[model samples]
Target: KRSCTHRYCFAVCIKQDQRSRHARGTVPTSKERGVREEQIVKKIFATMVGSSSSWSTALVKISPYTFASIGIAISIGVSVLGAAWGIYITGSSLIGAAIKAPRITSKNLISVIFCEAVAIYGVIVAIILQTKLESVPSSRIYDPESLRAGYAIFASGIIVGFANLVCGLCVGIIGSSCALSDAQNSSLFVKILVIEIFGSALGLFGVIVGIIMSAQATWPSKG
Candidate 1:
């Protein structure tokens, strides 16, 4: 009877020990926690990177300046893409038109060049945004407060890029038609030029908005 009682007490003690270890999130020296443990952060790398305990908990410690930079890059990249695509459309039409009507070759070529200028606008905005974004020191950790500015900058870039992109595409289509129509009838040239100017104005709107948002943003700098 005493032996059976001793056995029951041992089982109970083992159960209690298991519960305690589970609560404390500790493992026995001989056992492993399996796959989940594999992705756990390494102590050495974490220590070398930064001292913030929040870094250990968070999956990504992205710097706000990184977002701002992405915005700046996007502004330039998307805008250029639009401008290039626009120029291609306009230039193709211009070449085809010139082949049919040599008289329009000099005058209609300016339309294509004008479309190419839209991309240059993107370059200007990107440079301005880059100037606004200050670099953080390597020794200092990113500030949480800067996230608002980062988001604002990012949104501004998107707005400018897509706005310019659409504007450029619209202008390209109109310019292509204008080039073709102008070749057929020189009288249509002035009217189409007016439409192209209006199309170019769309990009200016994006620039204005971007400038406003970028002005409000201030990148964090190391003290």
Candidate 2:
């Protein structure tokens, strides 16, 4: 009976040890599980708040085609405006001066026609610019290279337009004065023609620069 009691007590001790081990293991496992759950919640909340990637991507997204079209229009339209004003200013003066001096009709007509030629120059430049430009693809907005190209072309158009505008107006004024002076004193026609030539030369400056600037402005695809 004493031997039996010793065996039974040993069995009870063994069972208690197993139960304690299970309880200790369960506690650590439960703690690990709670930590994992907290981490998951944090990640979910962060995602729900706006992330940097979407905003950054949108920042670069702009319409390159819109700017390019505007550039083309500016190139043509501004040139036309300058030319029309030049022609009107010179033509009206020529007509008035011709009435006062019938003998100077040929000289005054030449001055007015020279002013009109400014319009022709603008048309020619506009055609060249338009030809150089390629149509923008509808599928894409602004890519890096295309955006750079658009900016370059836009600058070219603006520079050319403003330069031509100023030169055309200056030349027109000079031409009108030339017509009147030539009517009053035919000897002054040659000297005034020189000034008008200089004014016309100013417009050519923009055309040369624009051609150079637009030379590399091909529609960018890869970047």
On residues 153-198, what C-alpha lDDT tens digit does candidate 2 reach at each position?
A: 7777777777778877888888889888888899999999988888
Any residue pairs clashing in model 1, and if so which? none
Point to the candidate with the largest lDDT: 1
Per-residue lDDT over 1-223 for candidate 1, one digit per residue giving the tens place of the 0 to 100 score = 9667655655665567667778999865644433323323343235446657776546246767777888988998999999888988988888887887988878877777777777888888888877776665665535554766777788788888988898889889998999899888889999989988998899999989988988878656666
Model 1 superposed RMSD (Cα): 12.4
lDDT agreement with native, every candidate: 0.78, 0.72
What TM-score does each of the candidates earn?
0.69, 0.67
Off by over 4 Å in 1: 1-60, 137-142, 220-223
Which 10 consecutive positions of candidate 1 have the poorest summed lDDT?
35-44
Q: Give the TM-score comparing model 2 with the true structure, all chains together.
A: 0.67
